[model samples]
Target: MINVGLNHFLIVSGILFSLGLYAVVTRKNAVMVLMGIELILNAANINFIAFSKFGNLGLTGQVTALFVIVLAAAEAAIALAIVLNIYKTFNNVNVDEIDHLKD
Candidate 1:
């Protein structure tokens, strides 16, 4: 424990964002892709909160971060529901295999 600081938070956020991007690009599973997107969003959220708490941005950043967290939850729910519907229709959760949309 090296007494986490602003730089530490930034580094963690960078790593999280990179890993999330890699997972999204390398994974073929729709659910995993969605999870990676969520991870990226969360990494950004962490950065916001860190700057809000440790930096001198005051409460504005905190309020914005709160809103972002709420939106992230809502987006996750809606996206997961859509992914479930896709899985039900295709019997698979692979993003590249979802092209049989009939009218």
Candidate 2:
């Protein structure tokens, strides 16, 4: 039987982080960048919970993860709103093209 441990969680989290980074770096669409940011936040949450469980950190990790979830939701809402505005003004949601604040 393979015992899943902290190392396993860490490895998975690392992979998620890398994927998030790749998406953020390579994607041109604002929505895709937001998704990548979400992925990064999720990866961090995974690490927090995993460390909390393995390091005997009580409820701190779980509580922090909850807070992070709430923050991520709020962030997504605000970002999407801004992206919508950008799309309305520019007719596109590409991150690179929306370079200036002025029309």
The number of the candidate with the highest TM-score is: 2
List candidate 1 segments past 4 Å from native: 1-3
Candidate models: Cα lDDT each: 0.87, 0.96
Cα error, residue 25 of model 1, in Å, equals: 0.9
Report the lDDT tens digits of candidate 2 across residue range 1-103: 1799999999999999999999999999999999999999999999999999999999899999999999999999999999999999999999888889968
lDDT for each residue of candidate 1 in 1-103, tens digit (9 for 90 to 100): 5998888988999999999999899998988998898889889988998998898888877788889889989988998999888877778878776787742
Listed in order, each prediction's TM-score against the native is 0.86, 0.96
